[model samples]
Target: MKFTRTANANWKGTGMEGTGTISTQSTTLNNAQLSFKTRFAEGVGTNPEELIAAAHSGCFTMQLSFLLTEAGFIPEDLNTKAKVTLEDGTITLIQLELEGKVPGISEEQFQELAQKAKAICPISKLLNTEITLSTTLTA
Candidate 1:
């Protein structure tokens, strides 16, 4: 099983003052604006770090849902946030914070499963940065 995703970017002018747009094949983003201001300072548009955070959070949440179901627990709700840090032109770390409610699961069991998912998720395995998971389980 193989899947491929595509996104395209177009830029005009120099890095400091240039503007660009990013579009993905899925059309989730179509000509979305981006610029140096957007990346390094306050501006209107999306940046690569934001996109990575979105992808990591979505992937980790889905993986947790699958793990909970496999463990015979019905997931009520799951929310995850992935924060990526960039320093000195390098991505330093990604922190995943999750809060979940599930029926018929102990906190220890939920934490175990959440850690398993964090270790096995595709994006987690793909990234070269340090990844950390913090989970809060609610009855």
Candidate 2:
């Protein structure tokens, strides 16, 4: 399988005053300079790591939801947060924090399902970093 997304950026002045655009025929973009990556978080567009984190978090949540449903414990709400840490200019760690309200399931089962989700999620498989999952079953 193959996929692609295009982003365009224009630098008017120095590093600080430059801007960019990332469009997938999508909702919106920014005028922040997201070139070279060093200018990240400096009034520029969202970085690659940030987009990756968004994809990872969304994928993991969907995976967990599917697992919960398959396990016969339909979740009332599923929330996931993914933190991406950069190591040596490459992504090194993806930490997933999950909280769900799932009735008729024990903590152990929730943990088990979460583990499966972590392993089976497509985004987790794509990432080369270690993934740690912390999950909680809510009332």
Candidate 3:
């Protein structure tokens, strides 16, 4: 199976003063505003790192759910937070913190699946930076 996703960005003005809009094929983001302030100075808009974090968190959670089901365990819930660190105009690190509950699975097994999901998730594999995972498994 093959899948493709697309997003478009339109920007006007200079880097320091420029403002832009971002849109996705799914329309999850439609004309979302972005600016230098948003990326660097906590402005009132979305930024690339924030988008990356969202994508990573969603992808990792879904992958873990599939892994748990494949292992004969029913997944109750999976909550993940992905933190993207941008430094000196470079994306340096991404940390994934996951908390999950699944019936009939030990912590060791859950952690193993979490690690696998982190490694194989499409966004994780696409990123060229350090990735770390912290997982908490609950009964």
**Candidate 2 lDDT over residue span 78-137, tens digit each:** 999888898777788888999999988999999998999999999999888889989888
Off-target runs (Cα >4 Å) in candidate 1 are none
Between candidates 1 and 2, which one is better according to lDDT? Answer: 1
RMSD of each: 1.0, 3.4, 0.9
Per-residue C-alpha lDDT of model 1 across residues 1-139, encoded as one tens digit per residue:
9989899999999999999999999999999999999899988899999999999999999998998888899899999999999999998999999999998899899999999999999999999999999988887
lDDT (0 to 1) per candidate? 0.93, 0.79, 0.93
Query: What's the CA error at residue 114 for candidate 3, in Å?
Result: 0.6
Which 10 residues in a row give candidate 2 its minimum summed lDDT? 24-33
TM-score of each: 0.96, 0.78, 0.96
Once fitted onto the true fold, the runs of candidate 2 whose alpha carbons sit more than 4 angstroms away are 1-18, 25-39, 42-44
Clashing pairs in 2: none
Per-candidate total of colliding backbone pairs:
0, 0, 0
Cα lDDT tens digits, model 3, 30-100, are: 99999999998887889999999999999999999998999999888899999999998899999999999
